[model samples]
Target: MKGKDKCKALKEIRAKIAEENDIEYVVSECKHKGDCKGTCPKCEAELIYLEKELEKRRSLGKRVCVTGLAVGMAATVAGCTPASVIDPIVEFFGGGIGTEDLAGAAQPPEPVMGEVEPPIETLDGEVEYVPDSENSSEEDCSGEDCSEENGSEENGSEDPNGGSEDGKGDNDIPDLAGEALPPEEF
Candidate 1:
């Protein structure tokens, strides 16, 4: 329902209640008549009066369902269209119309997932491994620090053959007494 329709419906309900209680119903013209937000003095007074009458009816043990009327009036007072108020209630009761009403304006667009291609296939039904040159820049190292030259004596080893006396030129392993564990443990 639009604002006008909601206002009309509220007026009809108010009239019906007034007629049932022997109260005279008067229709006053409002400046915002067609697009009444129910904030105007006339509409606010009518809603308050109607609420009071409903409270009286409830106090007298009369069963009155004020849910629809109250919500409609509240929505109008808050300057919201009736559809914005009613759509969620209709949806809560399993009505599918709400999604249609809320589709474009009220909802956010869905997220998109990137597509990944499979590895290259080979004739033997196995994925072929092609090493990329940009990803393979590993340098060969033989000592604790790759920055050290092969014949450097900074390690306090006087023997020039990497602390090895065997003329076969085999490098001797350094003392690991105070050294950290190898990277494989990590």
Candidate 2:
């Protein structure tokens, strides 16, 4: 339902609940903190529950409106209108929507000159048959602190686990191997 209608329905439900609780919807000093002057706690809780319900209904209505607008836009983008465009698409896809004579109804226009690039060619014996993917650019390997023109190597780091230049398990970090860790807490 629309937001206004849903809100009205919620208001009716609130009125019913208020009547059942012997609560008077007066313009008293109601701070809306589960406290109503000269009324029981049940009345205050019922009003709060009704308010939340009304808010949920309004939120749902807004979502439904937005979803409907999105569906409408999708339909337009998919060419749902203008039966001319749809019929050609169906015939082009071999659905045979129209006569067999006009098979080129949806044929795409010839691409403008130089708009499309020719595929890369590899000479049988003139050049090695290397796919474009196997080649790597310098930018692909040289990243932050890639010391040897490659990716980060945790094992070859400055830490002790990384073997030193002398081929020993030495590190530049402070030697705290003898220090004990803090005791584990529950």
Candidate 3:
């Protein structure tokens, strides 16, 4: 993307974000906060002037910053110390009223989930599942002396070759039973 195109795209996104965040609503909320003992004319005038300035910027196709919105919504009135500590926001509605918490006011939208094709493909045009070697332990056969955790023989007198209690293998041919299995048994 070219620089000009990217800038235009960002400006478009900024307009959308500004509209969705609704700076006017936040300003109204701030003005309604009960910190002002009465209708302070100074604070009201300052807020109204800031709102006009923000509106002018918007009309001129400029991107509105969340931080600026917070500051614009600030309510500074006389008889309130330096008056910079005052704000209309419920989150930081005290002497610390500033653009510090503006970032939290605007949250990004959540992602959407949808079905899609699998990423894998083979020469035969099918998705074949090949188990990973490191994680595969089902085929790990040590021998008859292995622990019963791997389903091997216990400490019983039965045949280590995996024969039944009646001294017969699973095939039931009744051959040489009660004997140790071959070293490389499957």
Whole-model Cα lDDT of every candidate shown, in order: 0.40, 0.33, 0.32
Cα RMSD of predicted structure 3: 34.8
Off by over 4 Å in 2: 26-46, 49-186
Model 2, TM vs. native: 0.17
Winning candidate number (lDDT): 1
Between candidates 1 and 3, the TM-score winner: 1
Please provide, for model 2 over 1-186, each residue's C-alpha lDDT reduced to its tens digit, 9 standing for 90 to 100. 222233344445555533432233332222332211223333334454433332332322211111122232112323344775577765578652222224443322222334553222211211112223323422332334334432123322112223235744321222323878899999
Q: What lDDT tens digits, residue by residue, belong to model 3 across residues 87-137?
A: 537433442222232445322221123534223211122122222441232
- Each model's TM-score, in the order given? 0.28, 0.17, 0.18
Residues 1-96, candidate 1: write the lDDT tens digits: 444455676677766655544333465544452233323445545655554444443333344443343344433323444785577865567652
Clashes of 2: 0
Model 1 vs. true fold: TM:
0.28
Report RMSD (Å) for each prediction in the order shown.
39.1, 34.2, 34.8
Q: Whole-model lDDT, candidate 2? A: 0.33
Off by over 4 Å in 1: 54-186
